[model samples]
Target: MTEFEHMLVNSFNTYIEENGIRAISYRLKQHRFTPQFLDVLVDSLNPDLYLGIECKSISVDKGANALYFSQHFTVDKNGIHQIERISNYLNKSGRRGFLAVELRLGTGHGREAYMIPWNELKKKYFDKDLKLTLQEIRSFPEIKREGKNYRVDPMEWERK
Candidate 1:
């Protein structure tokens, strides 16, 4: 697991425990020769509130405002997708699918994290170039670290 993934998982689990919510977020482990389509699974007391997350990260220079998400398929195999399988399963009715992307701004500059909805990700799959620029990513919901944790949980999650 990447450090960024760890950060999100840690933050979410901490949120669950700290708030005394009846929920649990855990990373799915991969078995031998088996691929784990998603990275995180969040189960809540509310059946409709289940969440699935796929973690991805990229590193860019300090002053750069644009980076690219691996997204050129049929033309190349270097895209950031699981053949749309993850999106297909998690994006169905009543399910929550999310992308936890961390943009590392080199060393000492820290990192910028964003939680993008699956609908947003699916929209990019139809782009002519099939790529997402960092400028576009910044427009999504940005996540920041607070103290030892990052706030990655939804407010309604605490209501339970």
Candidate 2:
């Protein structure tokens, strides 16, 4: 797992334990590529609690803005693109999905993290240019990292 994935896994685990969320979540195995190109998976007896998260981290210039979600799209050997595959899986399984993106803004500047909802990403996927400026992403919930853990509250989106 990449450093961000590892940290995200730890974050989710911590949240599950502390918040008493009865869900089993883990970071997916990574060897060149994951089957679904997903970084984290959460399974639960409650349908509302089930989730699949794809983690992305990008290093940008100090003043750089915008997170071109399409820039991360990739076609697998079977000609399936990442967005289509993940979207299909979550829809068929009736699970919530999110994109956990982190923007690394140079040394000592820290990173900006956001947990973007799947529907938001889906809307952008159909667009000619899937680019969301930082100001736009700010409309979504920001993820906070306390120490080494990330504060992600899926319920905040689930109940909506």
Residue 41 lDDT (model 2): 84
lDDT for 67 in candidate 1 is 37
- Per residue, candidate 1 scores C-alpha lDDT tens digits across 1-160 of 7677788878888888888888888888778666676788888866644778878777677444443444322222445456376766775635577777778788677788887776677767756345567877777777777864577755432212
Clashes of 2: 0
Residues 1-160, model 2: lDDT tens digits: 8888788777777778897878878875556554744778888887766888888777766555777655666777898778888899888878789988888878777887888898888888777557777777667777887764677777665314
Provide the TM-score for each candidate, comma-separated.
Answer: 0.79, 0.86
- Which whole-number lDDT from 0 to 100 does residue 36 have in model 1? 77
Which residue pairs show collisions in model 1? none
Cα TM-score of candidate 2: 0.86
Clashes of 1: 0
Error of 1 at 137 (Å): 0.6
